[model samples]
Target: MTKYSSEFKVKLVNEYFDGQISILGLSKKYGMPSKSPIYRWVHEAEANGLNYLITKKSHKEYSQDFKLSVIEYHKLHEISRLDTAIYFKISPSQVNSWIYRYNHYGVIGLRRRPRGRRPLMAKKKKKQTRLNPTKEEKYKQEILDLKAKLHDAEMDRDILKALKTLRENDPNSKKQN
Candidate 1:
């Protein structure tokens, strides 16, 4: 659909209220394809003043639950999209879009998703290594690493000894590969 400027909408609405031409006449005069937009503009202007006809810079974001309720209300009342839009003070096209999304994807469709490409993974920091360590530091580090490895090996040996005893005691237990 063509997007008309707020000024153009106000002018058309004013002309409509002038009592000189009907909506169809104004549509023909202005070469608008449909009278629905004019009707909507007039309704909005009358209900919420001319300022409401202006497109807002920041569109209102509806929550997923709010969208679900709107869809439920529309369905429960069996109302047209235009009527639901008017009741909710939202655009008819928005109502239609929500309904379409809800029908196609269930409630998850109403959820808002981040818009854009995914960010690249962060680079891992490099570990700092000592270029030349003193003999004492080198020996101490080697001792610590060897101690850790020895402790791990001792733990594994003890666990294996326990498992072997259990298997020997329980002759019915099958060995697992």
Candidate 2:
């Protein structure tokens, strides 16, 4: 939610217009953190209309050219970001962000980028076999594989044999069909 309501903002702007209190005085009277918001509100009202005060801005995407123009106008006029923002009917933070990006990365930095985490790269699996193998080499590999399988089967058979012998010797062992 917004810190200040639209009616309250309008009241403050109206108070400022009455010429009784300065921005700082109004801020102090209302216990505002600073007069920056008042300045923005006043500018917004003056630039657009009173409706601009009541209406909330939704998320907007500015084109690269529009961003560049805003930046250029700001640079050329030597105005504050708030002023530039009010002039362009955008938030001051948007102007600040664009300026920052432009300074760090130039005009291309204003371009919109894809959001969220990038897709993970898929890993390529290496081939297990060579492109070509001699018949003798293939036969030798097959023999080695078969021997390994046989050894595993023999080990399993021995374990079952040992388990059976232990179960037969144990009087406490339960018999099952």
Please provide TM-scores, in order, for all candidate models, with all chains considered together. Answer: 0.61, 0.60
Model 2 scores a C-alpha lDDT of 0.80
lDDT of residue 176 for candidate 1: 70
Query: Which 10-residue window in model 1 sums to the lowest lDDT?
Result: 130-139
Query: What tens-digit string does per-residue lDDT give for candidate 1 at 20-135?
Result: 99999999999999998899888878877888887777657888667866777786666788778878888889999999986765555666767788658748756875245456
Question: Model 1, stretches more than 4 Å misplaced?
Answer: 118-177
Candidate 2 lDDT for residue 48: 84
List per-prediction Cα lDDT, in the order shown: 0.78, 0.80
Q: What is the C-alpha RMSD of each candidate to the true structure, in Å?
A: 24.8, 27.3
Candidate 2 C-alpha lDDT tens digits along 1-177: 888999999999999889999999999999999998998888888888777888575867788768877877786666888889888888788899999987765654666777789658748665776235456535544554565567678889999999999998997896767
* Native-to-model Cα distance after best TM-score fit, residue 141 in candidate 1, in Å: 61
